[model samples]
Target: MRVETVQLKGYTTLGVGGPAELWTVETPEDLKEAAQAPYRVLGNGSNLLVSDQGVPERVIKLGGVFTAWDLNLTPRNGAYITGWIGAGAMLPLLVQEAARKGLSGLEGLLGIPATVGGAVRMNAGTRYGEIADALEVVEVFHDGQLRHYRPEELGFAYRTSHLPPGGIVTRVRFRLTPSTPKAVREKMALVDQARKGQPKKKSAGCAFKNPPGDSAGRLIDVHGLKGLREGQAMVSLEHGNFIVNLGGATARDVWRLVQRIRSVIPLELEWEVWGVIE
Candidate 1:
């Protein structure tokens, strides 16, 4: 609805970035009206490494009608617990709600940070599970038209869901397993306990997707890269996959570090480390 210069730090979980110039749209109608312009969507900014130079155009972010969630329990066919979840609903909140409603599947996804749409798009999850497993269908708006993709049609990959290119997710329908609330809470607590010792400050979850059997953090740690610093950006000592911004880090510093890591890993182990950045 309103366009302006945005400091990337405010939106990202990493607390590092520069700026995005142009309007930010909060509604689908607003997005449609400005469809002629080049744009990108930003969610809760959990898993992104923004450029220091910033994107040169509009970044449409859905809000308002975009952020509602509805839960339904169908008694037919073994108590199917379906949730019509909004794109902007926070992932943690969804997990919390699911646990409250006796949904067993989302317990492993407790500490993730992002809107439901972003989680669905990226297929965010831990080693134990991923969001796509429980997704039934997702509603998206693309090229001024609305469409729905069932789980089978969505093309769930390692960390990607093959939604139509340029499609903005509006809502997700998830069919969850019915379990006792106590059982769900216990599982959630286990996930929480695992996350408790990790640094809780600014971070973008895991910086790199794991390379099959090997973890990115383990690789970086083996290289003696823990607490490695460049300007204010430092690879976290506790978790090598995370790059922490100690107060005043720039996107360039983070990008340079990522480049350095990628270039060095192969030279050290003769193994390629692939990752995505935006």
Candidate 2:
């Protein structure tokens, strides 16, 4: 284990945040040991936004053994394959691997920046599909014990899951079907093409979840909130649901923009924002 004051900005995809007491665990045993105490587990940091004041909680980042994955074809069921992926395994890499193996289910997640564990926890997805669609089981460590859980037990819905409190997902098993490589590639191509409208900048994916039957992006856009700015943060012109950090944005800058949007929209239908804000 390597311990240090790691800058949260470098860890997150948004490229903005203060420092945190960080520990990089290379083995499962170390990870479990670190979890024995109160700590936040970080994956690719794709869906997170830490405060500019820095996090006080100890942060544990998985590595080495935790990034390994195993793939096997089911016996007598040549059309089906099972993948056991570690929590730290990158989602985009996994999608590419699935395509290379002629797998079909994960092609829709081609461009998402997340880990298997994070994706499962958030039920991450795009219009094509959600991670819950292919997930079979999740292995997690919580309260000093490691356990396996099925999707139903997790209560997956929308962009959330009922994960155990302070639980650290260690691995995930996905059930996928066999398909032609060309078909899988084509599906991935479509997914990539659809993402063209998303800003290619520092952002924590979507800033909020859609409200009921309405899309958050549509609401924000229709209300003329796109391009709205606060300090260095601005609502993405390309996608209303995204808040991009322009060069030296702070957490407060993003929060200010969020508040501005909330002021105009009804509270009952307000977008649910994520991230740690002080």
Candidate 3:
């Protein structure tokens, strides 16, 4: 494992944040050693907003051995195929890999920029399906001890899974159904098509979770909050729920815009805030 002091803006999708001590742990033993010190596990750095002042704790990122995943195209007895994936494996690569392997279940996760562990931790999904739909077991290293947990035990809900505090997911096992190459590609295309409306700008994905029986985007749009801007951060006109970084936006700017939006309509924040927002 190697440690470096780097600007957090380069690590997150939002492109806003200050400096932090980042540790790249490549192996399980590396993770155990890193965990001995106070740390925070960072996935693909999506769906989060880190403070401009940065955090007092260290940020640990999985890599090397933790980025490996095993996927087999052929099933043993013409049944479901099981595979173990590292928490650090990027989802875009896995989605393409699965498609190439004639797998169709992950189509719903198209366009989500996240790691396997990050996707599972947040139950990342769209209308087609969720990551939890095919998940079986999650292996995590917590408090210097390794443990296996079923999905039910994690309390999976919409866009969120309740993992114990300081629990670092090391790997995950998934069960997927095989399909024809053409069919799998088609499903992925459809899922991608559905996501075409999302903003292409720098953002931490959706800014607010959809309230039950209602969408935060719809609410924001209906309230005429589209195009709302604070500093360099703005509510995307394409999708009201997205707060886009219009270049050089600060974390405080995004949070101020978020507060502006929240003032008009009550919506729960979907993005996990790091450090203080004020």
Candidate 4:
């Protein structure tokens, strides 16, 4: 029943927002109660854009009690390992955990900043990888109850998981093939290296999903939108698809820049770009 004001700019990766009325949920029961409070669920706050006017609504953020990790080995499929990871667990932590356990599937998502729940919702991935591929089942809370959904039921697709909107993922089970820990580490290092080449400042990761057979950054770069700035929000000089906060960026600034890019790209190069913004 505790309500606090949140400085959302500090809470999000974008670093540009006002404040939210927030409540911290420490347990599933707490989450259930908070979910009924007309608030948006806030996970690691990486893939969202908040209005500068701020989130006038209540926000529910879950904490570490939901971050448990468990592993079990199976005999039927050449040392398959099953990981039951909590939704509140950070993506990088889960990646490293799976790597340490000699599981080979999640190495491609090494440096992404988000929680498992967010990753499950967005099906977050790079060109060669996705979290949904390795998922066997997802435990979720919806409609005031908890349920498990198999992969087929999840309807996973590019950059999206087909959970009914507003459903909260509580845990995810992964099916992984066992490999040598050294091998897993090598693959993860490669992913880290690739990510290191991108902008590493205050950003909301990729601003646009790549269109089929082409890259979003390449298109934006071709249009010369890289390094474009408006009120402290700059289109990254290093990666066009990313807009970085340059000390005083606001949500309106970011939104305007995105619209400018989208408006020009279609007319100039006949390329369609869609951005996910709040």
Candidate 5:
């Protein structure tokens, strides 16, 4: 295990945050040991925004054994396949491997920078599909015990899951259909192309969940909030729902911009913002 006191900005995709006690665990044993105490589990940090004052609890990052995944093709009726993936595995890598094996399921998550655990916990998805759509079983460690859970048990919904508090997902099982590699690649390319309008800078993906059938980006854009700036953080001109960090932006800057949007937007819209602002 590697231990250090480091700035959270280095760990998050947003590139802004304060310092915290960080622990990198290489084995399941180490993870369990660390979990015995109150700690925050961080994955790829794609959808998180830590506070400027920094996190007070210990931060645990999975590595080594947690990243190892095995692909088992179990044939049933000779028409479909079942895949089991490690929770710590990267979503993009899993998509690539599935495509290579002529399997079709996770194409919609092509550009999302998240691990399986985080994706499943958030029911991460786009207009194409969600992780829960293909998820069959989730193996997680909770209260010092390892258990398997069905999708229904998770209460999956828009950008949220009812995973037991303090639970750590260790593996995921997906049900995929047989497909031609060409077709799989085409789907992935289509999703990639669709995301061209999204900002490519340092951002915590979408800043808020779309309200019902309405799009959050469209609402923010219509309100003329795009390109709005607070210190070094600015609402992305390309996508209104995203707030990008410009060089030395601090977490406070992003929080203030979010507050501005929330206060100015109509109250009936009922949109929920993502990230931890502290």
Candidate 6:
């Protein structure tokens, strides 16, 4: 285990937050120690927003072996390819691996910048598919006890999965169909194409979850809230549901903009916030 005072802004995709004590844990025992410290886990920091003032809790980051995944598929069953993946592995790495190995799952998650553990815990997905579709079991280390769970036990929803408070995903099992590399790459390309027009600027992806039978972006667009700004934070003109950092935006700016949109549309937030804001 290692500890450092890291500027959280440098870690998050949205590019906000200040300094906080961050622990990098490489072993299972290290994870337990950090959890017992009541530390919060940080992955790729996608779909997350931290305070410019700094995070309230000590943060835990995975490194070393955690970032490694083993898919060694010399398939006994020609129909399916399965493997245990590390929590710290990025989604794009899996997507690329899937393409190379001709695995026909996780291709739809091509553009999401998320860690395997975080993505699975939240059931992250696109319109094409979700992590749950490929997920079989999750290996979790919580309160110094290791446990496993299936998709049904996690109570997965559109973009939510119920993990015990302070639970940390250690690894996961993914079952994927065996397809030709050409086919998998085609699917990946299709997913990439579907994601066009999102803002290229710094962001935490979609700020709000889509409401039932309606898209939050559509409603925000209908309300003419696109291009709305609060300090350096602004609703992206490209996509209404996205709050883009114009540059040097504080966490408060983003939170204030979120409140501004919620005042009008009453949408639920999708991004997980790590600090209190006034």
Which candidate ranks first by lDDT, i.e. highest? 3
The local distance difference test score of each candidate is 0.75, 0.82, 0.89, 0.79, 0.83, 0.87
Question: Lowest-lDDT window of 10 residues in candidate 1?
Answer: 267-276
Every model's TM-score:
0.89, 0.93, 0.96, 0.91, 0.93, 0.96
Q: Report the C-alpha lDDT of model 1 over 1-278, residue by residue, as the tens digit.
A: 77778876777777765677545566767768756677777788888776665666566676776777876665445646475788988889989888887877887778888899888888888765788877777898888987888878888887777888888888888877889899999987877877654666577777777877888888989999888887888888888877888888877777777777887674222111112233
lDDT of 6 by residue, 51-166 (tens): 77887688999877778887755454453546678899898888898889888888878889999998987789999999998877798888689899987888888899988777
How do the candidates rank by lDDT, highest first?
A: 3, 6, 5, 2, 4, 1
Worst 10 residues of 2 by lDDT: 266-275
After superposition, the stretches of candidate 1 with alpha carbons farther than 4 Å from their true spots are 21-27, 75-81, 266-278
| Native-to-model Cα distance after best TM-score fit, residue 170 in candidate 5, in Å | 1.1
Candidate 4 accuracy as TM-score: 0.91
How do the residues 1-278 of candidate 2 rate in per-residue lDDT, one tens digit apiece? 88899888888888877888888888877887777666887878877777887777888988888899976656333446475789889999989988898887987677889988888878889888999998878998888788999889999998889989988888888888888789899998888898889999899888777887888889999999999999999999999989898998988897888789889875232122234675
Could you list the CA RMSD of all candidates, in the order they appear? 3.7, 2.3, 1.5, 3.6, 2.5, 1.5
Ranking by TM-score: 3, 6, 2, 5, 4, 1
Clashes of each: 2, 0, 0, 0, 0, 0
Consecutive 10-residue window with the lowest summed lDDT within model 3: 73-82
User: 36 in model 2: Cα distance from truth in Å?
Assistant: 2.8
| Whole-structure CA lDDT of model 2 | 0.82
Candidate 6 TM-score versus the reference: 0.96
Q: How much lDDT does candidate 4 score?
A: 0.79
Give candidate 4's error at residue 44 in angstroms. Answer: 1.1
Top TM-score hit: 3
